[model samples]
Target: MTLPSGKWRLGFDIGGTFTDFVLHEGTTGALTLHKRLTTPQDPSEAALAGLDEILAMQGIGPGDLSEIIHGTTLVTNAVIERTGARTGLIATEGFGDILEMGTEQRYDIYDLFLPFPEPLVPRDLRLEVPERIDASGRVLAGLDEAALERAGAELVGAGCEAVAIAFLHSYANPAHERRAAAILRSAFPDLAVSVSSDVVAGIGEYRRTATAAANAYVQPLMHRYLGRIETALAARGFAGALRLMHSAGGLIPLETARDFPVRLLESGPAGGALATGLFGRAAGLSDMISFDMGGTTAKAALIEDGQAAIAPEIEAARVRRFTRGSGLPIRTPVIEMIEIGAGGGSIAAIDEVGLLKVGPRSAGSDPGPACYGLGGTEPTVTDAALVLGYYDPGFFLGGRMALDAGAARRAVARVADPLGLSVEEAALGIHKVVVENMAAAARVHIVERGRDPRDFAMVGFGGAGPAHAVAVARALGI
Candidate 1:
């Protein structure tokens, strides 16, 4: 495939721990790939750095690229970390409480103390306006313009950087929400605004409102982030279409992604699904499973009939982590998958009852694993793997960075001392727990969809997936 180069298509993916790059020659079938540690300080920097390095390797420049496709965990991380802009909500007078009371369906009937996820807009910031619309798209009462202005001004005065407008029956009749958004924009042209009907107009009030609120919360930030990337890429002589991969299994231009950032929530995981489906078909497989374990989390998806399964909706930032109805609901088409807080950087520690537990918390790329020697003290999956002699300290990452075996042993020993076991024993326990967690989650996801795991070929990718694939496959009886 080493022929004269044609036009180039460059792709970059920003995961929790690494930014991966792939450079493809249009007609020559040549490709160059690279992976660099992620810079959480500003993920764009990592993208640029990786791009430059890949260009140098390919003997090309930014101007030689015909297009750029980028995807990242930024929007999802904002929702999970609650790091987006301060946002307010505007609702119909009698229906403002919908922000708290959902469809009145219990996600878990046996758990009495199940907690609801916090609304993006707090109670004090949720203002109500007098308006009514029937389910049949007829306006029962005209919008209260004075009330709308008052709510907008109150939100502005409350220091809200963004606002969500969700009126009763807006999916059927968006007049009220549209007017409300217009009024707010006229009052404060700079405040980021989102209307429920504009985001999801199909059905389900709670899911629609929650999705719009989530979008508004991240709208300004996403807009600015994309703008920054555009400017930076332009400075590097990149003058091609800049597209972002969305959760629904395809790519959308930057503007579309900015308008509906909530749609980007599963973009990273969706890539894994798309790739698995392609690989399965290329390998003459009819059914398969994709396992992607990144730096912070692991995701699993089922594939059949040469397509990845898709779900109608998803929950974001669940308080209890994996329980349904415990987080903000978003009713968007998604390649159905299950995600768990277990990965290479997943922390291993003793629970309250002194039981060894793998993560719901990750060390991420910052102070990554203790083996990175970046000041991380917690015992993570990477440290456990090192202690188990799975890696050669001198050759990790092609020796781009050295691994610290002493630090890995010390970190695993920290967990070992509490469990009254040797470091090697504790490391084995941690490894088993990590693999079990992933297998258990994947099994539930497959079983719920009425499938047999043993019938599907497992396709594993990502930083840690291949390393632990055999253990996970055996645990799942595949």
Candidate 2:
């Protein structure tokens, strides 16, 4: 966890569409920036590639770096896309359904057909074992070691990569949970285990269980992913400390990050908010708003008196998009912000009402936007921007990659024909809809906090933020 004495420090943020880098020289205070298309298959590949390119630009070797601060959307994307490892949950007897039951509170009370996010672990994988700890930290029913072993065996046989143990009142005693975890690890050496007492250590059953389950879900993935980055860096003679950004806008050691990947749900956004606070203060502004729009999502946060607020909990994979109670709850500290699935690669389409809509779905870096000429045929916000002459087809990515205007037009035509509008008109509609969406969300976020949009300066950053910042600001009357 200690940084070596070196001249350079590196910071990088990995978003859905791109991975961005910042290299700073300690003595000279010079900064170099670089961006690369994110490799969705393995995000570490993009990170390593960008690191090499940036270091090469300055003729500096990896040994020159004293530390590397990384912020990524890995855990967040995995939860949202349901791409994490196959995980099993072990809860107290008759309480195995706590993850599904949630808080039993509706996010939207008026809607009769409201949908809830499905539990990450299916019913078949969530097994109950005989164990109970009373509220006073006393063992009411002794741990059933045999039943625990059987449940672990079943989950391992079912190909589970990780397991979560959440006994009733584990926060009070934690003895049964620790014993169960030790037994499971002894039986399955390769399995990743997360106990509620180690992950959340809280009173609420649903939140504690869900948080532990989430930690287990992403544990194996984070381990493999971090290993790749470390090995790649070490191969190039890097011996510096590697720290990860937490959701609360602070850095944590690599080991802590590995054990609690759920704490990194908003790591990238937290980085943006932190940077916004620093830059806003440098500009002598005490109150400012941060607008960061990347490839897959847009985030807005309010910084008051040079500080970003930290929330006690965060929700993810919301079934109803921005709606509060429609997502999985994870009990972890996070920088408070409003995030929406509206970004450069956000897909554009005609909804059931025949109205043009954008987002919640994205053309990620695998195929990217239609304009990327990377096999994507869907019309996205990036495609619309290119169709509306907002980008130079031949100079995109600084001419390292070229865009296909014709492909963008064809993609936009799909929705245009159905809506009886020209391609250009459809593109404009797409842009306007996205701008309005961001502005509306930002407005709500600001106003709800008893702050007026006009009172704070808006500082926008990110690949797509600058393009739409003015429009969003105008819409907000800021």
Candidate 3:
């Protein structure tokens, strides 16, 4: 399987809200854009369907395909929703509760009821083997063979199809982790095992171990998803190899993805940055911010001098929207961005103080906004956009999904009357609130990095980003 000589490179980004397809013809430098409703049930199905439709429209066959670059939020969703396989963690004795203990830093030091994200692996599912590896990567206590056997048996008995083995300081010394993995493999040859040292070599024990655990948690799902995609592509007469875009905005072979599934956590956002980078260059902008508001979340990244900012560590599934140390920290190369639940489908309601509040909870595409007529009675950011004139009810998604403005008004009215504001004012307030939320997040992220928002131009994409960019920029005082 190889790429064709032609300049036909296809880039597909399967976002939480929409599946975007871009066909770039090397010959003419011409681009064709296609957007389709995402099929979360099987995201690859939407990709395939979108691919076929675009190929048909361009009158090109599979033979004309040079390369296909794809990205999705499948791994992120799996981890955030806790919908991955029943997984287990294997650690050195006395350190089995590392993940549970975490850094022990409170994001809200003064708040009494500070909530924490649940550990990916439960305590009972976290098995400890009789082994000790010091911070210097030296084995102070050798692995107890009998204890390993018993732990493996217990994990297997607990129905752990996948297990993560993260020994202390394994990044510096992997001997103990390697030995434990060997023992587990010998005992349960079919079980999937992930080691922290190999996945993330960064310092910070909790983040490294958490990253590895998250990887193991989603490994089986990624394997099945990628395999299914390969099969579907082969059946479609696309004989070329399939490459997945990683969170770092580079294409990695399927083998790499299968082994380090966690790297794809921010894959979808990476593609958006790549797209934004290309657009920025074309538009003669060197420094810019990429704002992507999809269905499930809103992602923002800062791009300076035609390069997207990248961070080596980021938290996932944060309990608090803007709080640091409030989520599982993963040590991986990812485009630095802040994600908030302020997407088009973000639910809007009134807080306890009778003040209108926008979301960190989304309606998703299943029921969608009340205007979608998909049985969703909740008022969403989309509904607010419809009422605020930012979205033309008849021209949304190029008129693919007809919206009911009346429904949106009614949904907004449910919360508007209590706030003593008209439906239009309430909808506008919702839009303002969401935009400010994104702007505030960007400001904090940029300032914390010792940069200024004014130094970056905002490059907006996704369904709602373009609509809210101006307001968000104004709110940021840019």
Candidate 4:
């Protein structure tokens, strides 16, 4: 690829704990990197702040950039934290419960008490209209426009911000779904809508509906977020093209992403995986494991033949973090990765079994770790790392931000005193526990594919990846 002279491009990723920015001068091929704690209230705050800081550090304006590529965990976090728009699902008559019914295959067949996440759309909001389409693209029953209008009215009356249209056999023939979407949009101009056929053209009643529902659930939020970023950049005199990273390790236009927000489920992780593949290939390693440990979670993906694996479908908002079917299954192409609930911001506590457990829960960037001195009292993996001398408190973010050692000690002591151990011991325990958790996830992800962890090199990314990479690799005997 030849560089366009004097042009600049920026790439940024918004993680749970931190937002990272990279400014590239296209002509000189120079790279400038910056990292800052994320703003949970409005993620774009951190993104734009980081962007301005980076550009200022390079003595350049936003208009100097020709393009900006952004990847964020907003959609994934919204689904997990249930902070997305209040969405309703409009499905074929008598099939409104497909989201709840699922595939009937338990994620853990041996475990009698299996848990699945609640549907994004509640039963009351899952309205049904008179519509049916057979598997062979034949319309068995024409769509009832009046029924759809009534359903839309009921949903809008109930304060629905977005709506999903998934009629039976819509994959074979999307006429009903399209017509229903058009009607809803025409009636409720402010409502964001997603149609199953538009989101996924493949066949699978439950999967298609779930994917569209997921898209609808986050459509409004993505729209607002992307719009905010664009407006902010334009205000800074930016005339560059803004592209969003999707879950499939590809870049898509802002409009396309907003319409199909479900594809952005693993947007951030996919970027990391793609980078891993690129760097791995550069290092002459065709087969490796990409380990990205950030604030909320650690994701591991296999890079074979210098490419990341793409899964046809991915689960979101899993009740059990590591359980395969304990989540809402959305049929969309995504970079296949195993996510472990162990990261820098992951909370640490003693489980009901009297054993120390690291999270499926994260402090995120709001209060962050206890050491951040942001009113967080809970002990997080970052606090443990600080207490164990793994991170220099005063030197954090190159002294741009300070970590409180006393706060870290106090936070770790809560767990240490209860376990009858010193604070340092407890911190070490926290660190070791998280490392093992990541190693275990990576082991399963690799071995299940008839490959050995030792055979594949481990390429680490994210804030915590490098810190725990060696320990995790050793734990996996790699």
Candidate 5:
């Protein structure tokens, strides 16, 4: 199969639940969409398979493909699931506990049960060398080579596959961190090393150190995944250049992504925002809100003047819901979006206090919603939507997965009967509650930035976004 030389665009998005593929003919801008189940074990398998199916259906070959814009959740999954390599941290002596100390702000001030996120590198894996760099970028004490060697030996003994070197004020000077990294690399040639100065050249020691450590934790996984994909693509008789979509809503070369995989942490969400921004432009709307409701989470982003808001830093794997400084901070460029565990597969249940609580937990795609007939016994938001007649069971996923209304009603009854409400009322209540939750999240994220939701038009996408858009908009009094 020869590659096409002109006028064709291929776009693929590997979402949490499904992988969506689009092939557009440049001349007419006609597009075709295909949906496939995402293979979490190896996402590229699904991508390659989907691409083959799309190409065959179009009777086109790889050579006919002009450009392929792709996004994936590989990096995000690595952080959330803690499936990355065993990582060690090297920091200035006496400050090795910065990650544990965090901002010293309690996410749940009144709750004694409030849990803090575990550090990416455990205490034993964390090695502190004798070094001091002040806030003014002055090296108050030089790094001790013997101390670094001892730390390196300990880390190697602790089975660390990667090491993060983050010294106090390294973002400003970086000399100590750089020297420490070189010494570690010299001792452990195969160990992946990430320096805070190279990862995040921003202020805030805790944030910088946490971001660098997170990057180190996920670097080996990302490197292997990307390397495999690149090799597979090259062997497929396609010689075109490959580019990865960044969390900042722009495409960066493969080399850049390889060096800084953290930048792709929110790449999937960024694509949705990009798609929404394009839609807003076509509709001639300037101030817009992009709402994306997928299987695991619902995300909202504010777009003003045709541009999505960008944040210099974002928190990942937070221990508490809607709480700042409760997660590992990642200092990478990303589209500013608020995400909540309020999506199609978010479990709905009654709390011990007799109050209804929606999720910060989800059924995800594996078991999915009970209505999906995929072995999920718990009632989810999608099941609630099904019981409310908001979703057509026959037409879900554009008819890829059939929904079972009977199962949905049964699941809703379990939660609603205990709440002293009828099934229909319970389903509608669940829907309303989730909508308000999403709206409230958007409100907080927007108001914090001194913006109002009323001023922004909503551009909703994802499997559940379009279904819940009007209700959320009404809740916001839009």
Candidate 6:
């Protein structure tokens, strides 16, 4: 893709709670920012809405933008919510259970009842064929055409829109996988197929297989979303080159992003890290830790010497937030970071043990927080913040959207009354709990990288990041 010669560039990041924008005028190096509530029903709506408002307010038009870089957490959210398109997996014979078995190592040794994220492709949808390739890429048995065809028929019968092909040793030699994909595509030309080698090249069977499955799971959804966004932009006379932010704090074209949606999983969070790193370098800081708190979750990453730590493996949709190996291990190029389900819209409730706890659950943007007065009855971090006097109810969203303080107090009372604590006390408790949770996560996150939290300077961005950055930093003694 090529960018046209123009004086303006536009960028947007789509998050669970809000969509953020940045418009930069190349001529004067001036920048403008904007935010909008995310439209979950159709994410493109929020994106286009924000783009139009920003351009119009800044006295610019679509033709003035030479480039647009967009990123979204939709792919990762789909995996977490199990809301992607119907997907099926094809594996070598006797390996259909690889996704479930998952290396047989316990992520938490002491926690007996450990919960694992459900496999993207269920057991019944995972088909097997008579094909074998050894560890070093030796084909011990040839591909079984009849078995493959039978599996393809089963998948088609199951109404699978996407199929993932991950035969054993495909990373070393992708011959069998390529053949399987060809066979399936020939049978169903419209089916989206993701081969193991083409998605992620790795030696681990479970990681490679899971990665391919994730790509297939979200391929159809991402394809439709990107197509819709492009059409909307084009209708507005935008002729700029479109690019997507990736997990490694880099950009990729639309075609590559559509084919391998797995790489876009952490795209939005990576953008924060990159921006923080740049600002840190300009200030001549040695080690910078980036913190981004959005609507659905909070994330922290380490940047040293102007580079964010990246890994070839990432775990998605974790059952236990802080525990390692509890989620689907996707082998992709991802910026290394620790993420938790604690965020502004995270729901607060009392567990059966009569203890108050924050979320792995969220209210999202549709209803949003109770204070938003958008039909949400549950207490969220935003509501708690309102109760604790951290936000001006009348001036919320820069007065564009007013908040209801009475609703926020009532929502927080649910947790407060249960523990016989005052509403303000409960609200403060909620903030402390979430901050402690993030602080504990950050401590572990930095420790894993052979670094101390006190050794790094922290930079918090995003809508919710700045609000609690001080407490988190104090918790880490940074």
lDDT of 5 by residue, 1-478 (tens): 4433666778888877778899998778889889776777878888888888887887886667767788888788788888988999988899889988888887667888878878889988887889887888888999899999899888989899888898888877988888888888898898888989998898898889888888888888878878887787777765666777999999988777776788889998999888788889999998888899987788888888998888998889887767886778888889998884387888999989987778867877777789988788888898999998889999976787798999999999989889899999998888888988888888888899898888889988887888899988898878
The sequence of per-residue lDDT tens digits that candidate 1 reaches over residues 1-478 is: 1333338889898998888889998887688888888998888888898899999987788888878988888888988999999999999887777878888887889989878888887889888889899889998999999989988998899899999998889899898888888888998999999999999997777888888889999998898888888998999887778888888789999889888888888888888889998999999997989899888898888899889877888888888777767778887888888884498999999999999999888998999999999999889998898889887788777677789999999999998997799999999999999898888888888888899899898888888888788889999899
lDDT of 3 by residue, 337-444 (tens): 887438888899899888778887888777778988878888999998888877888877677668899999999998888888899998988988888778888888
Number of clashes in every candidate structure?
Answer: 0, 0, 1, 0, 5, 0
Query: How far off is residue 80 in model 3, in Å?
Result: 1.6
Model 2 TM-score (2 dp): 0.97
- Please write out the lDDT profile of model 2 over residues 1-478, one tens digit for every residue: 2333777999998899999999998878899988899998999999999999999988888888999999999999999999999999999999999988888888788899989888989999999999888999998899899999999999999999999999998898899999999999999999999989999988999999999999999999999999999899999999889999999988999899888999999999999899899999999998988999999989999999999999989988988888878899999999999884499999998899989999888998879998888899999999999999998989877787888999999999999999999999999999999998888888887888888999888888888888888899898888
* lDDT per residue (tens digit) for residues 222-317 in model 6: 999999998888988888799999998899999999999999999999899998889998999969999998888999999998888888788888
TM-score of each: 0.97, 0.97, 0.94, 0.97, 0.93, 0.96
Q: Local distance difference test, per candidate?
A: 0.87, 0.91, 0.85, 0.90, 0.84, 0.90
Pull out the clashing pairs in model 6: none
Could you report the Cα RMSD, in angstroms, for every candidate shown? 2.0, 2.1, 2.3, 2.0, 2.3, 2.2
Q: By the lDDT metric, which is better: model 1 or model 3?
A: 1
Candidate 3 all-Cα RMSD: 2.3
Comparison by TM-score, 3 against 6, better one: 6
Predicted candidate 4 versus true structure: per-residue lDDT over 145-195, tens digit per residue: 999999999999999999999999888888888888888899999999998
Inter-residue clash pairs, candidate 1: none
List where candidate 2 sits over 4 angstroms from the true fold: 1-4
Question: Which residue pairs collide, candidate 5?
Answer: 2-63, 3-63, 3-64, 4-63, 4-64
